[model samples]
Target: MKRLLAVLATATLLVQLGTTSASAAKPVRSSAIQWMGHSWWPRSVGGAPGPSGLWSPANATVDAEGRVHLRITRDRKGRLVQGELDTMDNGWGYGTYRWEVASDLTAMHPEVVLGLFTYGADPAYGHREIDIEASGWGRTPITWDYTTWANGHNPVSRTPVVPGRSTHQFEWAPDRITWTSWDATGALLATRTVAGADVPVPYDESIGMNLWVCGCTSEWRKTPATEVVIDRFSFTPAG
Candidate 1:
């Protein structure tokens, strides 16, 4: 009887260790950003005009390596989902913003948009905004746009992005804004410059990034589970 009891205790210890090991092997989910937030916008609630899709923190994650992963998938109700992050500071001014696309964006559906932009008010208020968007725009894949709001001015570019990492940057100055995209090899893919009257000046807005479906419908985004990884993001204020 004593030997049997000892063996049972040993088995219980082994089981506990196994459970602990399994838990440790699992990847840890990150905490939400303090200054950044996300939202879920349904199709009925003025969806197509803005970041026009559903968003949840569960669809965004920062791994131990500090890479931000924005995922798009279908929910249990068959609704298309996406992810967004917006800075809490609404006092963003003239500066340089840069982001590295760590995933193969070419693999994503044409309707999938990876946007780096700034937003203030609605367009009716002559809202000042700038965008570096990668999307199919209801066409083929690997299309990009550098746009300025308030005037519907956008320079479209069709550049084949390599299936890896790349860089996108914009410099917002008081007189002009420059947008550039670079391939993984550090080669320039496309660029757009807007100056003179087209430059959006003296506007304060929050800088944001999102991975969303264009029309919140499968007609644009055929893939159910899509993701965009951002390796790094930085902002430099003007001196």
Candidate 2:
């Protein structure tokens, strides 16, 4: 966790609190990274993607298959560059957010990380963040970490990411938040829920996706590239 825990440059995070991740990012290949019917803005915080290295909008692009690709690469300067995107909509609260991953996460570099989550910039409700992240964090057998933060405490659920298409989701309401995972065949991989005051209330939070070199240069020195593909993101308000 540390500074990267819930800290996502609140000043910048707030800018992405534009609209819900509905049908807006349209998939446009070879140019702008428009995909899945929503608008996603590629961003760089302090010239880097949080916790280290540089960021390039080029690393975030849409494929001909209509998938969102988040990647990490070594630039001509030998600088490790990562990628992240913020949804261009706000007004989202208390809803079910789902992301379908098309990559084989288990094959990714141990130090490389991919995250899909909702976040805000204020201190309330721990930056109003909830995350579904896949990374080994220098460990083997890449795992997916599901987390909900409140104040400074974060409740997490870690589970192995299966091969093939996988869907990660969280349903947030006024009283509770439910997290679930399903494999390509719709087999339940894991599920967990948190209720009461700890479950963060929805504010001006929006969706985001990122791929970064987690262990920094020490680990990335060996492999300067990695990537993950997000098939699409969908949201349904908790009515």
lDDT of 1 by residue, 1-239 (tens): 00012332232233323344432212111222532132211111113332334556677667778777787877788777777665534546788888888888776676677787776532321346678888775556666677776455545344666677889988888878888888889988888777776666654465667777776344753655788888888888877
For all candidates in order, the CA lDDT equals 0.62, 0.73
Q: List the candidates' TM-scores in order.
A: 0.74, 0.84
Best-matching candidate per TM-score:
2
lDDT of 2 by residue, 159-217 (tens): 98888989999998888888999999999999988887668877767678888867644
RMSD of each: 16.3, 5.3
**Count of residue pairs whose backbone atoms collide, per candidate:** 0, 11
Collision pairs in model 1? none
Where is model 1 more than 4 Å wrong at Cα? Answer: 1-46, 49-52, 122-126, 156-158, 216-218
Candidate 1 clash figure, as a count: 0
lDDT of 1 at 93: 74
Q: Give residue 204's error in model 2 in angstroms.
A: 1.6
Q: What is the lDDT for 209 in model 2?
A: 88
lDDT of 2 at 41: 75
